[model samples]
Target: MPSITLIVNGASKSLEAWDPDMPLLYALRNDLGLHAAKFGCGLAQCGACTVLLDDMPVRSCSIRIADAAGRRVVTAEGLGSPEKPHAVQAAFIAEQAAQCGYCTNGMVMTAVALLRAVPRPSRDEAKQALAGNLCRCGSHERVLRAVQRAADSERA
Candidate 1:
């Protein structure tokens, strides 16, 4: 096993990974105990395993642990807490954007990236940013509203 160092959620962690090619999702869930990134489609087609790698939304299921070395990885667990949630998270709650809640992690993470890149995105841009993420429960409208609400809050 080789030791890999990662900066996750603003914290530095050294983890033992037997395989360098092991998906980052495994290390995050099994070793680091971060469950926000789920395994939806191991192929990375679904965005359930989304997380922010250096402020960019990435599919944790397809990325190798070795590749994530020294990068800033932010999972949903790191995004916010009950006391002070991230703007996107607070918006999701305010907009009631989740149904089954399986895809909310991806949606929120992706939204965070988009908002960071574009402080105020148009409706279409918000839709395009979330195109990769799938919500089986069909809460697309609410999700859009949540993104907009987050953007609005940021401007306020």
Candidate 2:
């Protein structure tokens, strides 16, 4: 087993890797108990396993545990705390953006990354950033509104 150190949600954690080929999604959920990032398509076709790698959103399912070493990994769990939630998370809650609840984590993480780059992303830009993420419950409209709300809240 290869030991790897990962900075997840601004916290450093060390885990023994059972397989070098283990996907980050498994490592995150099985090892570290960070299940906020879901498992949809193990092939990366779906955005259910999306997480932030050094502030950029990446699909954890496609990335190996070895590849995640020495990088900042942030899942939806890292977005905010119960006492202090990230603007995106807060916005999503206020706007009721989640329908099935499976895709909300990925959506929130994507929105967080997008806002970090563009505080006031246009509707198209918001949609574009979230293009990889899919909501089977069909909450695209609410997701867009949540992004907008997050942007507005950030400016406040």
Candidate 3:
């Protein structure tokens, strides 16, 4: 097994290599003990395993650890802290966007990237941006509001 170095949450993490094809989610969860990204569909269809790879949201469950090697990875935990949450995290909390919370991590991660790209995105834009993220709990409305709130909060 070889060691793969990854910049996770702005920190360099060395992963004890298992398989080159293994999903990045496994290493992040099992090795780093970061469980924010869930394995909802093994496939990349569900946004549950979404994480920021170099400032863009990618499906962790589908992305191989090798592909993520030497890349900048940011998980939900890396987004912010309890005392000073990221604008998106704070907005999600304020808007009560999470239902079961299973999809919250992905939602937050996606919104974080979106807000960075389009700080003042319209409601429809927000909806389209998060179209890939599936929140079976039917929290779409709140999620959109949260995105808007995050944009507002960030600009404040």
Candidate 4:
């Protein structure tokens, strides 16, 4: 077993994994007990297990735990709390962007990264940024609106 140190949700955590190639999602959910990132498709196409790695959106299900060592990993739980939700999270709630809510984590995390990179992205840009994330409930419209709403709130 290898002990890997990771910065998760602004906190440092030491996790042990038998295989260095173990997916980051396992360490996050099993070891660290962060459930915000869900496992939809282990293949990384669904984006259900998305998280922010050094402020960039990444698929935790595909990233090896060793590769995430020493990196700043921010799961959806790290994004905000129920009381003081992140702007993107608030916008998602306000827009009712989630139907089943399985994909909300990925959508929110990816939107946070997108907003950080492009403060105010057009609808097309938002669509492009979220193209990788899939919502089985087909809440694309609301998700886009939530991203725009978050952008507006950030500006204000």
Candidate 5:
């Protein structure tokens, strides 16, 4: 157990000596009380625990907390506030993209990261970027639409 400092959601914070092998997902949820990032598969096969590390989506459940030290981590909570929503979050709501809502955060974060990389991703690019994220409720169509909607809204 070694103490490590990490930048999460634009804040510099420190974690006490915890198990180095523990995944970042647990640390964020249990220790940090930031439960927006879900834990779908601890093995990293599922993208349920996606978060942005330097604006790139990464599966939190796969990476150890120690490995995240000194990096900027942005969770869904970091994306937007309740009063002012991020374009992606606003678009998701506008498109009614969520069904059960379990995968929405990760999916939204993935889409946000994708749009950051390519403002106007082609349909295929959108699909490929979101491939790792799974929505068991079959919201892919709406999700894609939401991304496109966000892209449009961002341009406005």
Candidate 6:
């Protein structure tokens, strides 16, 4: 087994990966107990498994653990705490952006990255940013609103 150390959230963690080819999602979920990134299509088409890899959104399901060695990985749980949620997380709650809540993790992570890059993205830009994330709960409208609200909140 090979040992891989990852900077998860803001802390460093070392784990023995029996197979370095294992997806990073498993290490985050099974080993580190970070469950925000859910298993979706597993092929990386769906953004349910999105996480910030070096401040960019990447599908955790397809990113190999070996490839992510010595990189910054921030899952949705690492975004914020319940008492003080990230702007996007807080906006999601305020706008009721989630029905089943299955896609919220990816949405928040992507939104966070988008905001970091673009700051105040237009409605179309937000939609484009989240186009990959699937939310079958018919929450697209709310999700859009949540992104805008988050931008506004951050501005304030």
Q: How far is candidate 1 from the true structure (C-alpha RMSD, Å)?
A: 0.6
Clashes found in each candidate (C-alpha, N, C closer than 3 A): 0, 0, 0, 0, 0, 0
Compared with the true structure, what per-residue lDDT tens digits does model 1 show for residues 1-156? 689999999999999889989999999999999998999989998899999999999999999999999999999999899899999999999999999999999999999999999999999999999999988899999999999999999999
Candidate 4 lDDT by residue in tens digits, 47-66:
99999999989999999999
- Per-residue lDDT of model 3, residues 1-156, tens digit only: 889999999999998886888899999999999999999999898899999999999999999999999999999999889998998999999999999999999999999999889989999889998999898899999999999999988888
The global C-alpha lDDT for each of the candidates, from Candidate 1 onward, is 0.96, 0.90, 0.93, 0.94, 0.91, 0.95
Misplaced by over 4 Å in model 2 are none
Q: Estimated TM-score per prediction?
A: 0.99, 0.97, 0.98, 0.98, 0.97, 0.99
Candidate 1, position 121, lDDT: 99
RMSD of each candidate? 0.6, 0.9, 0.7, 0.7, 0.9, 0.6
lDDT of 2 by residue, 14-110 (tens): 9998787889999999999988999898888778899999899999999998898999999888878878888999889899999889988889988
- List pairs with backbone clashes in candidate 3: none
lDDT ranking, high to low: 1, 6, 4, 3, 5, 2
- Measured with C-alpha atoms, the lDDT of residue 112 in candidate 1 is 98
lDDT of 5: 0.91
- Supply the TM-score for candidate 5: 0.97
Give lDDT for model 3. 0.93
Return the clash pairs for model 1, or none: none
